[model samples]
Target: MSILPVSSIYLIIDLISGFFELLEYTFYRRAMITGFLASIVFGIVGTYVVIKRIVFISDGIAHASFGGIGLAFFLSHYLVFSFDPLAGAAVFALISAVGIGLMSKKKVQREDTAIGIIWVLGMALGALFFTLTPGYQTSMENVLFGNIYMISDVDIYLLSILVVFVLVAVFLFYHELQAVSFDEEFAEVAGVKTTFFYLFLLVIVALSIVFLLRFVGIILVIALFTMPASIASGLSHDIKKIMLYSWILSLIFVMGGLFLSYVFDFPSGPTITLFGGIIFIAYTLARWVRV
Candidate 1:
């Protein structure tokens, strides 16, 4: 690996100072914290997602969140009840995750076929609901591409709880999770509850998608979820080490991308995801050359 020169050291100092100044603002602070929590959850969940080769299922759930967003906004108009779009997304994500999880097991249909149908249905439902929504106009940009500035105190709290939940779940069930990830039939024959574990894993994935919504939006959450894990998988065969490396890689991408967006006035979600993709490509190239 190459090292930075003295000039680069000064640049790093200046950048850190600027980032600290930005953190003085409440929204900036929340964005950074939220990004940090998101990194942790995504890293842990993403390891199983990558190793299980269920990236498509994750993608479907993320995209399906749009339906929940639209449903929340539409219901808020006439239902005399308050609805949080994020909550709606959580609900829809769980439904989609479970639905797809079960459907993929059916011998009657191909998994991709089921995923594609649900994917399009979710998008269409969202569009219909958003179009019919009255009075206030929704910002498609914010819906499709997230703005870290939109993160709130409630989001912070929810994400904090989620990170803790994920940590505990993974720690307690690490062996079972590992068993299922590598081979479901072997795990089943060994008396593991394969079906329950499979659905439970998908539920965790749903929550991860919801937690990432404010930071990356539904459109780009999958990128942040999968890319870091992809890079980590290339680097480590041990699941625990892969999770740790993925967390570190995700943090670097989230923080560096946030800084880059702040400096260049780019959309934070896509900018962060783009940075992750670039880093993965670079890492892969370096590994190939070394080999």
Candidate 2:
């Protein structure tokens, strides 16, 4: 009443109500719901990824999944076999994850070299297969950049199942995985199955990449995975606490994405990714300055 003008207060209230009204749309609601769900995975897995310094591993798996998509399409169209691209993507992702883990564990090649080779090979295979497929491949556009509004009920169902799976799996092996993530050599010396947990962790990463493909595209998904945990790590040293903080931070980052997109007439994926990048960068700079 004193400092704020009456007109300004009404305008603010109008904007708030209008924004909530936008959520009434089915697509916007789904976008927000899936975004929130993805944040949970992002927080837990992202914490482990940052702790273990395996940020780019998910990138490779995500890219590699393209090959599976093409293969699934080819099989479905040419052989008339029923196949889901997402399932194919999950399969390819698991293969890539396991391959990377084994190669690094066995000292067969530099980890980055292995990842790069797999990444390109997957994309190349995807392109080749798509070219061979008969019709104009319109669906692939959604796969490349993501279209949250175009996400289906089936996608949400699958995402929900994967979230539950990830939670239960993490809960059962939290301590063992935590130890492996924080210090593999020490954990191995301490009688933990470092190799098993390491591979298991990568498997989780692979699954996450596949499920999150719709909400965030392949190119931008890594930032969401890497940044939330990195930010939480700076705030807290305790792993569990870091995950909790990261989850909350991820929730916040996703909150305004849809509204910004609606307002600015932009793609939902880039809006979300850019929003996250700004927050991540701000936190980094602030932390650096404080130091």
Candidate 3:
């Protein structure tokens, strides 16, 4: 007589599972907010990054920051300080940025070659530093793959401030950034202070990379920086539209990946990256079909 009610109990269990799923999604929503803020900055800057053929430069900075991560671990272990690895990363990355910027001015060496040298040297330093430090191996995993659950309220506040700062700066210098991004020689002729802007952009990139390392880690951070913007750029013809789509797509990936990871018991950063790759491939295929 009660057999007919079994399906109702199953449905109730399903509903409870769905409710927990929704609750779990709140974490991912926070991740999406962080990713949204990050991708917008990256999208605008990454457009210029890709346009200037400085993709390798972004990779270089991302990798070079590993030195800072290792140093941060050493400091955290020995100095009994509570310094965020991200802070150390930003400091070192800014140094690398300045170094790269200065080297770019030298006519004897190409920017790519200079960046390549810095990249290798930076990683080597990081490896050496980590090996010299005690109690680094366990924590180093977080630096490489990231732990999205570590996104604290403080991090959210910091990321919010950075997003606002970058947006305002970009707005205030829209014409200048556009000019420099499109044609540095023309921008220089037009009194855009090309060198200043170049340096400024590098610093901004460094900051962005640092903030990203917490969620995506040093190894996969560049994928977050470049992939959404690349997908959006392929889909949009206008700069504004590209940025808009990039943020939206980034939001989708972060949220979707977070949800999937929670549901499937997978790592957050890799899930997000895998989601971004799928979106990029799907978008590319769609465009190819249309063409």
Candidate 4:
């Protein structure tokens, strides 16, 4: 007695048919391209995030971007200025990143406390803005849960530019970033301008979060950002190796999750995150057994 729904069986058949005739489906192609670009950015920046142990702050920035998205929607009708939610998320993410970075100083405030405040405040503001927007029906499901099928040619172009810029910038500054991630005091002692580099890293994180919003949404972006790198970190201590592994793992998770979503009609973002979590759990179990 199988409990599989008839739709599920039909989906499996459709998936097989679609595999060979991939070009027939524009949505699938767009998702693949977007996922690939997202994996690359996450691989590069997430390694640094894991090494620096600022995953919490990264999560904060991701959530805080919601405030920007809500604000964009609220202002678009009334304001003379053009309002792009993605741009709004970018601006809000950067502000949150900079705020977290500056407030992280021991003399100023507890970093975790600041992150908690930003995280909660961001959601609260978003709720308030949504409430105030007149006659605008809520469609925040896409922002909150993500729908990679919604990605457009413009998004692809923007992602392409962002990926190139991140790769080149990080490549040029690899050594400095490496020093700062492993040991900030030592980097400062070596005249690495730790504050400047730290700020630069946070800004990159902000950009990455904004770029990933459509692909994974704000709710699951943190998982995509951290899980692949986390798995990589478990396998290697070297930053380069970790990044490479993260990219490969992320590709697997995203591609497999997309296929599963297409077949079973599940949300792509959570499916992807779920796959990553499963892998992480297996790795952890393996390590524990080894010990």
Candidate 5:
């Protein structure tokens, strides 16, 4: 009753792998190496992203970076300037994070509303600029829903360096992060720089989102960032335990989805997201039943 040729799909992937082995000296093989590195970085960063309750902001940052992507393309094409789309994305994402943090200080609007407005406006600007620039649509489409097979060795190196930076920063500030997440007022009274930690966390989330966009794309990056942590948080009582569980869970989803996609001729992003969603739902249901 299934429409898919499951067996044939596996055969095709096997053939593809064999072909890749034959072309092992080529740049395409380097792309796969970069992809693996990206996957690991996403797993670790995603844990903190979910723990901090910044899923909405992560989505906004990812979407907002589209404007930067557009600008990068326009500059590279029209202005004769060589620009890296990821670099531009990182810059804009950091700017957006700062704006979001400042807006949080105001009581006039909810944080969610501010994030939504920024998200839409950023996307609109991206679209407008893209339309004005020739040959921009193709580049935007790729950024919107990444082509994983195009990853490069340079990309892998950059991602690994960023991963190390994020991990070290988190390790150094774990207590402050935990305090701010649990209770901002109490954290401030206890001598934690709550505002600084909050801003730092948002900046990290923004950078993670930008890094992940090349692998999962803007549409599904939020799921990878939030779902594993959401499920793990439900099962763990302590923040440290939650982060540990979340990292394990994220790795499982990435490895499982990547393998399954290769076996089933499916897209990687949705496969990972779907598996994460299933696990999250199952965990929730089990908790409900136990309670």
Candidate 6:
């Protein structure tokens, strides 16, 4: 007997057909390219994120990035020169990442509380600045929730540069990062600069959050960042293997989620998040039953 329910089997068939029909559009192709590029960095950085146990910090930084976007708008209007929102978001996220890292290191506030403070402050600042921005902010929802179908050629180019940077940086710093991630105290004793590497990792994550903002938005980006590595970790304990597996799983989830959204006329970002969640749940259950 077929393992899937009959209705699900039919739905798959329909999705396959609809997916092909939609592929003729330039937007769909761009979305596909975006997925491929984003998945690489997601898998790499996410592995570190999961292993280092910093998912919450990543979320805080990602959300905090919106303040940068809002500031970009304000600056453009306030100073009378064009300011890139992505640039604003990048700068904002970096500051948040450094702030969170420094605060967590200083012992003045609990890490979670520090993260929470930045998260709240970011949202508040973004809202205040956005309200002050002149005219209707046509792209506001896109920043909040993401719209994959609206990606442009320039966006793809920038994302491509990010993938290259993340890949090369990780490859060069892999041993130091691995050391610091697994043992801050030991790494420090062993001559690894734990503080520098720790903050460096967060900086990369900040950059990744800014670039990923366009695909899944601030609201949904954390799921995209964390889910792939979490799913891959369930399959392997080796960090290297986990990174590779995370990339493959990310590709599957992104393409599958993209096609499903298009086939059913669903909202892209949330649909992708839910799609990953379902697979994650089913995988966990299967593993539990096996154990």
TM-score of each: 0.93, 0.92, 0.87, 0.92, 0.85, 0.92
Q: Alpha-carbon error at 235 in model 3, in Å?
A: 2.4
Q: What's the TM for model 6?
A: 0.92
Each model's C-alpha lDDT?
A: 0.87, 0.86, 0.78, 0.86, 0.75, 0.88
- lDDT for each residue of candidate 3 in 20-100, tens digit (9 for 90 to 100): 666666565567667767667667666666656667877788889888888877777788676677877887889988889
The CA lDDT at 1 in model 6 is: 44
Model 6's alpha-carbon lDDT is 0.88
Q: Give the runs in model 1 whose Cα sits over 4 Å from its true position.
A: 1-15, 135-138, 289-291
* Clashing residue pairs in candidate 3 (N, C-alpha, C atoms within 3 angstroms): none
TM-score of 3: 0.87
RMSD of 4: 3.1
Worst 10 residues of 5 by lDDT: 26-35
Which residue runs does candidate 2 get wrong by more than 4 Å? Answer: 1-15, 134-137
TM-score, cand. 2 vs. native: 0.92
Q: How accurate is candidate 1 locally (lDDT)?
A: 0.87
Worst 10 residues of 2 by lDDT: 136-145
lDDT of 1 by residue, 35-129 (tens): 88999987889888899999999889888888988899899876999799888888889999989988876546698988888888888988888
The better-scoring model by lDDT among 2 and 5 is 2
lDDT of 4: 0.86
What order do candidates take by lDDT, descending?
6, 1, 4, 2, 3, 5
Better of 3 and 5 by lDDT: 3
* Residue runs of model 6 more than 4 Å from their true location after superposition: 1-18, 134-138
- Backbone clashes in model 4, listed as residue pairs: none
* Predicted structure with the largest TM-score when compared to the true one: 1
Candidate 5 lDDT tens digits, 78-196 = 78678898887888889998888878855567999999998987788788878888866667766887656656666777777778888798789888887887788999998887888
